[model samples]
Target: MGISEMRRTGEGIDERSNFIMYHKGEVAGHRGVGFLVKLNLKSQITGFEGISDRIAAIHIHLPNHSKNWTVIQVYSPTEQATRTDIDNFYNNLTEITEKYSENNLVIMGDFNAQVGARAPGEEQIIGKYGSGKRSENGKKLVTFLLENNLTILNSVFRKKPKSKWTWLSPDGKTRNEIDYILTNKVKEFSDTGIIQNLNFNTNHRMVRSCLCESGTKKPRPKAIQMNKTQISNEIWNPITAPEDLMTVATSDIDLKEKYNKIENKLKEQTRTDITKSQQTYLSEETIKLIEDRKNLITKKDKKENQKEISNLSKQIREKIRKDRIIKRNKTLENYISKTGGTKKALKELREQGKEWITKLKDKNRPTISRNKIQNIATDYYRSIYKEQNPNQTKTQLPAKQQNIYNINKIEDIPEILESEVEKSIKSQKMEKAPGPDKITNELIRGFQVNGQNRT
Candidate 1:
């Protein structure tokens, strides 16, 4: 996982979620850090420094902005590291933060610290919404922020305790907000919180924050962000499935009706889940705003409607742009990757800029036209098939092959024990891609195996 990509591209041991990479490896490649900058932003970068394997920085001077932005990305030593290593890391960070202290600076990445809620004297650095107890490193973080005059942006925003955590412990017994974004210009922050349901490919829940500048009074950003955890808990309510939900789906008409019923049940469970959105990238939160806009279209408050519509439109566009940037990363372990894919998948990825098959060859004749090629292909396939006798009992097979059903070995396999199924589910790695049912492995792990093996 690239700690550098944690903010925009995501970080994890599996395949990276970005096409572009800016990485620095540390700790024997385990703690490799990298960034994925958009083309427009990359062009504005005045400078970048790979200070060390565990840290890096990018300097950007936005057009007409009075000050430049110096982003210092870091990955601190873990709790188990020697005290010297930890101390050295903080010392290095202190130097870098001091260097860009004058700029509109932002520091981000895995701090591996829990600052918890706001403390008595840390009103300027820490906010009331922080979660988990402050660890030793958390104290160090608080001191660092205070010394540097940086605000913990995520902490300033109210959120569910469940939605505040950035990392989930291996055993799933602990959830802590260790990853963070600290900025000297806190008033520019429009929103901040954990972005749940994102496929970050890491135990750490992705954190996101919005910044809006060019204003007189820096009012606290009131845009309440939504995440999957909050949506599923407060919005979605599952309907009970009928006992014979699948039994009556034998005929085409029966299947269609059953499918429609199930679809409606899902929609009814989440009242505003319904949407005819054109963009595949739109999230539940964005869709809800879309519904709101639709309702506003028919109201008498044209003035209010126009203002909100413009704001929603701008937000929707921004969300799409960011979501597009976040969607390009791919891991090598996946069935299909940038370097590996089936013939068809590879063809699409390669994008050779032309049709792969421009012409077809005819075997029986030396000369052939494009139209004739189609006829020849059609005739060839037609010659391979023939009408079968309607009275035939079953399909015939070669002696060695026999019939597929005749070689059945179903009875030879032992019955699967419920305990075994439970163990399998429990052992499944979280955040894995789901199977044909679209039920993720994490969700499947939550189900109970109620019975024992067949006797």
Candidate 2:
């Protein structure tokens, strides 16, 4: 069997019941539920000959075609007929009978075992022992009927003396009465009141209770209330009759289709519009904002670069001092090697090397005071240079050897000279264009006079 069919029947039923409850709520609770059923289905088999298989368990669906139901089919696969299955069927019958005030417990389907045989002392009787056939499977079914107190309605239908056989074998010769409908719960109906439908081509005939209407017409279950406002807006309320049920059920299918189509169209439109929006260029105001942000970033980057340059310069000076100390060590080693490796000669050499060592030590003493003035001068030059030419680079600066570089107050020089520089640039741009004026003047200063004298 496929996995779908292999799933536990109880779990499938529970999930289906939950789904129904989610969709159908406001129809008066489980109390007023009823069944609308079509049954005895075989593979693709239609009409009266709906039963084709040798044997499988039967199921009775509940009212309004929901998931919860009682089992009503007979002659399940032998392996499938466990105690649990039988007990579940009996429990559901009791549950349904108690669930609603109205008598809606319908036990209709083929039950393969006959309750009693015609001959007395040969088969099991209604009350007597050994009166029925002693088949092992048949005994279980008999016990189920007796224990549940279900009444066999077929016995009442026999009062009219209808055709005796309820099922036929394929061979046509071996026929046994097996199919039956039983119920002890519903009142106002008996075995004699049951109606057996025409043969309908299947082995078992369709049997229905006379107590049941030909067919019931009732309101469809209302969908769950999503919200009071939305539900009220979406559904016309106060549905009172079967006509209203049909009207509501029929419109939902069309509305659902319309809603799906509209959703698809909206998705397509969004995709198209998104592409156009991406290709559209930015407006001028947005461009200016971006440029301003870039400028701020540029200024920050310049400040950081200058700081790094100052650090690099300091590191270079420290490296120079370390190199001088290494050179001094090498000199001392040379002087010791030349002193003939004797202690007395070495002492004399050391005395002579004292002044050299002092000079080397002075050179490596980490000259903070001297370098501080140089650093201040460097800072002043950099500040004035950056102020005077905000956009200038070292490679782009003018090479003129100006005296301002030697001045201690170089920081104030930019403010003093900036206006004069600006005026000079403007004055040069404002000078008149260098084109010669034509004045309709003096014809073009031809070699010959206007009187037409020939040269």
Question: Can you give the lDDT of residue 104 in candidate 1?
Answer: 92
Per-residue lDDT of 1-455 in model 1, one digit per residue for the tens?
22543332222211122223455554553665666565535346555556677787767776646898888788888778899989898899999889778899888889898888887888899877776688999998888888888899888888877678877665546767889998988877788877654421245766777777564754656853445455455533122223223333344566678777654433333333422112265567767766666666446553445566566667767776665554333222242553365554333334223211213556744321334555767887887885677787986788766554566643476799978886777778854555544445533343222332111
> What is candidate 2's TM-score against the reference?
0.27
For model 2, the superposed segments whose C-alpha errors exceed 4 Å read 1-75, 78-104, 117-135, 160-162, 190-200, 212-455
Question: What is the clash count for each candidate, in the order shown?
Answer: 3, 9
Query: Per-residue lDDT tens digits of candidate 2, residues 303-416?
Result: 333344344445545654565465456545765676544554345324221110001122345221223434555676888877555566655434354444545456654464
Residue 272 alpha-carbon offset, candidate 2, angstroms: 42
Candidate 1 — which pairs collide? 15-331, 17-329, 18-329
Candidate 1 Cα misplacement greater than 4 A, ranges:
1-20, 213-455
How many clashing residue pairs are found in candidate 2? 9
C-alpha lDDT (0 to 100) for residue 211 of candidate 2: 49
TM-score of each: 0.45, 0.27
